[model samples]
Target: MYNLKFLLLAIFLYSSCKANISITSIDSLISVTDDQLYENNVDYITQNAEKILKFSELNNYEKGKLYGNFFLGVTARMHGDNENMVRYTFAAEKLAKEYDDKYVLAFIFLQKATIYKEAGLYNSALNFINQGLTVSNSIQQYEKRNCAKGKLLVYKAICMSYLNPEWKQILRINLEAMKLLEKAGKPFGYDYNYLNVASTYETLGELDKAEFFYRKSLKVSTGNLKGMGYCNLAHLAFLHGRFEDATNYANTSLDYQENNSNKRYRDIAEIYQLLTKIYTETGNTAAAKKSEKLFEYYHNKENYTNELFKKKLLIQLLAKAELNQKDFEMEVSKKSRNLLVFSVISMVLIICLGMIYMKQVKSNRKTIEKNNEQLSELSQQINNSFSEVLELAKSDDPAFIPRFKEVYPVFYQNLLSRYPDLTIAQIRFCCLLRLNFSTKEVAHYHRLTIKGVQTRKTRLRKQLNIPSDADLNLWMMNLG
Candidate 1:
């Protein structure tokens, strides 16, 4: 009985551990699929993604569900299943947003942009590309953010080519995309970049540059991309009227397409069309007729696929439009909230500035008032000193000259410095005149007649180089 109990406990523990391991393995599978999404293995992705979705549902794993749906959407796109692609991607987008997974959200935006581009909705595609870039800004992983942004820019350039085929602008955008991808690491979609730039150079009639890029594209291409490169080269040869080279390139493209499991119908159709023209130009009516028939078949098939895709896309667009309306309303609410916050901040800033200004003004007023008080006190002191000096002079005290020199040192020094030859009597006469004393007052103070005072003034004027018309009393006061 003890052994049986231990065995039961061990079985229970093993089962629980196995279940946890299974869930962990699902997550691991999803992670691996995420990295391999950009590769050419659609079947592997679809198979693993389906398994992930099934087990994720059983285990209630959020991240597993998100990636499973996303990877499946990507595989649907590869297989040209427009309806399932939109459905799975939208489902994944909802989950991504719910979890606040910015990296996956950005990639979803990129996927949507590619969908729109494939549907011939260039403006919509560009809008999604912009949204992808906006979301990519918030991704914490440096390499992931750069890779996401680079892929978006690549699609943006492609959309621009369709909307406005300005070759130089397209070239610049493609080059920028290349730089960003290179910074991210061994760029995932470098073949597409080379292919786009090659087409642009070809359009611009830069044959040498176009050929260089075309070869570069071919060098990196695999599967459908290899066929695409050959088809493009065929078109380039056809454009230059090289019938034999065009025929060879077109045949090579057809051979690759036939062997490629993930065949691009449009590229194949384009190759057939090119072959039709090449055979016609070379005077092979039989081959031309066969090529023309094949071109019609493939071209019609491509058109039928596009029509079906557009119809499904239209339905999804309508649903998306309704969702977009809700999003628009939410955006408007967000903007209004932001605007309110900004207004509050601005008001606070203005109030702060006003307070600072008022404080500064009050400080300046106090400074000015203090300065005025100091000036008034100095003026009063000067007036008291002058009254004492005047009283000394009126009393004819012997100390009057020395007192005057102390009270008006600048005046005494300037007078002596300019005319050092003045005698004591002459200096005393000049001092009374400096005090604004009249000629009679000077005569009374000095006990001299008015003529003697006038005679001294005339001599003093000559000695000091005073103008004759200038008043002597005023000149003596103004000397200092």
Candidate 2:
């Protein structure tokens, strides 16, 4: 069901919120099988979530609603839908904070840390994981606290592994996690810990140790973890120069992965890369090329770009939140006399600025109108010049480049100064891009396909080191 209230709540929470919550739906979510959670049965999860939310609302069970949002967030995460995952996670955070349940808070915090870690904000991820650890320490249940602590240690190690490639340190942390898991007698869901330790040893150039743990993980794990174990063994086999064994292990990994809905992209990428190397070493150029293409395809298909953007924005928000709290504390520390004096001074400045602004606005308005008239004429002349050059380009006239330079000397000079070796075709594309032409318009103007224009823009962006999210046209305009 389409839920207007839930949608609105999600929006409001993203903006910011507070609410107490119940955990009824959390139990239901926990009881669900991994297959059911990961299968492409979107309608099943959506309907289940809606029912849980509706029941919670009707019964005034805030905990259930909170858990429903968290469940939805996890489901969205599985689907690689970061936007909805963020929304649902934010909603859950609000309720968890309001409820003041240490266990729930710890769990929610761990989920957020994982989300941020996946998004590539290692610093922000580590901060939240520490918060989870602190809260988990306060939990009354020994097994629950131990399990949460263990998971958090693994999460922290994962983030650190990214920030620094010191495999031994990461392995030490994972070992601690493993100890906690063993102490809790709940090591069933944590085969990834072993895989991580093995991968770290592989990174540290300890193939025998890596193989030992990989086999251990395989013995203890099933599904995606088992698939990942096979993937690692394949990579290890290739490293050991056993091409046939590598091929066998890689195929086994793919078979398991193909049968399961849960994804492990790194494992898939590694498998393809290993296969490519194997084929190359075994003198199968055709198979090697195919595997190399597959490797690139999987690597590019990983949702790293958007996730990194989200993480960057989220870290900024977290910094702003901390700054706000510091400002509040400073405000609370101020004396009444200082506050009164500051307020009076601010009011006086505002009134003075208001009168000055009124006179300046009147003067600037007439100046702006005159400037607008001149700008319109200049813009028309520039457009006409561009059109002439474009027509010349269509005819393959050698004079087109010089004529374009004569018309837009500043822009051309700026581009030339920055990129002296830019091709004539690249220069033409830049002119269109600077004029803020859409992809379709640029394609039509150049008599090329849309994909060709897009490819040009992509290549140019990389050449210029422009960020994916940046406005290329605005950036080009500013260059001049």
Candidate 3:
């Protein structure tokens, strides 16, 4: 309970403020790599990119022009500024293709698919994901190819989930993607992949599994993805009729948008719609109106931008379909049937899951208590050992060294195993050093002068043939 409250508080604090990125120079801007920028909050990157675009003479350097546009597109995508995202992506694509940049083309294709996916164009998203995979396969760069392949599989899974909603099929695809990610050793956007799983489960009303993967997604999310996790959690709360919790979570999601400057317009609009419903249901009409007005603000913007994207995407798809109408029709029919069957199954599954939820909740509670109890026991053991070791360090008794060895027997044994030539007095001195005692402290404890302690340390260092530059105290401590 305490941990849950603390987690909530931390989420609140983190979502309530914008993170400030301090890149003040053109050199700093140029040095900001894609991975670094991706990990940053949206607004921070957006503003920094704008600064560089405005102040830096990017035209003077070709690489600068390429990176600048790519960075802008990334920030725009997170911002849900689809128009700008498409524009920047196309510009970058032209330049990349002109330069015969195979690697950058793979990344660009993935980014385009992501933007299309966010814009609710699943077919286009899948097409671009396929293009990305094609580029990935052609690349001989092992790590890059693997990473791109994993990402494409995950994206394909996402497109399939939205288009088909076949939970079991989606799960299988995600499993395949996970294996690829593990092999690649670079699992970028896997959090979103987990999120897609959670969303599928939630659609099926398998609340238990949905909650499990939502938490999993939350565990791995960074930047804008973290905000999306909070939004999903808010929706889950609403599903369970936990209005107050939903309101808190929705606001937290909004805070993340505001802080990160990503401000996903449609998501924010939906959150306000949620807030309005929550407020109205709880007899807060004034608050509901306020939320409704906020909803209107973002809803209008979203509709305008989304419509533009849809029209463009439809035209693009139509042009491609002229020579493959039969294939497109077949694909559409197959996916439509998949969605229909899944929805029917989901309705039946929800009823069954609803019946079992209470029992599962009780079982989960007991399991959590047992785990907490085990954790407490392990923590206590560690604390006790630490206390004994510290006490042994300060003691002046003749048995102090023996007590120390008793408390940390493995450390003592390791030292003797590694340095068998040391004499008894030297071993005793090494033990004192293990406690990180100063020369004066060791002298006072052992009833020897400081100079005597120093001489003993020097002699021990020579016997061990320790490098002069090496920290003697650190070396002794590490022996443990």
- Highest TM-score, which number? 1
Off by over 4 Å in 1: 1-20, 323-480
On residues 1-480, what C-alpha lDDT tens digit does candidate 2 reach at each position? 469889988988865433223243344554462235433345577667766767777767876777677667767766766667777877878888887767667867877787667645577679899999999999898977787788889888888888856777888998899888778776464677788888888888999999998998898788777989998998888888888899999999988876777565666777888888899899999999998998887776554434333433343334434454455445544533454455567886766655555565565557556445434443544455567666765565666666656556679899989899899788877876776778888777568899988898899989989999998899888887
Model 2 pairs in collision: 21-62, 21-63, 22-62, 22-63, 22-64
Better of 1 and 3 by TM-score: 1
- In model 3, which regions exceed 4 Å deviation? 1-32, 37-88, 91-101, 114-121, 161-164, 178-188, 222-224, 241-243, 258-260, 277-297, 308-480
TM-score of each: 0.63, 0.59, 0.48
Sort by TM-score, top down from the best = 1, 2, 3
- Estimate, for each residue in 229-320, the C-alpha lDDT of model 1 and write its tens digit: 88888888888888788888878888889788767678888888888888888899999899889889988878756654554465455456
Return the top candidate by lDDT: 1
Count of residue pairs whose backbone atoms collide, per candidate: 0, 5, 1
True lDDT of residue 110, candidate 1: 82
lDDT of 2: 0.73
Q: Candidate 1: TM-score?
A: 0.63
Candidate 3 residue pairs in backbone clash: 43-260
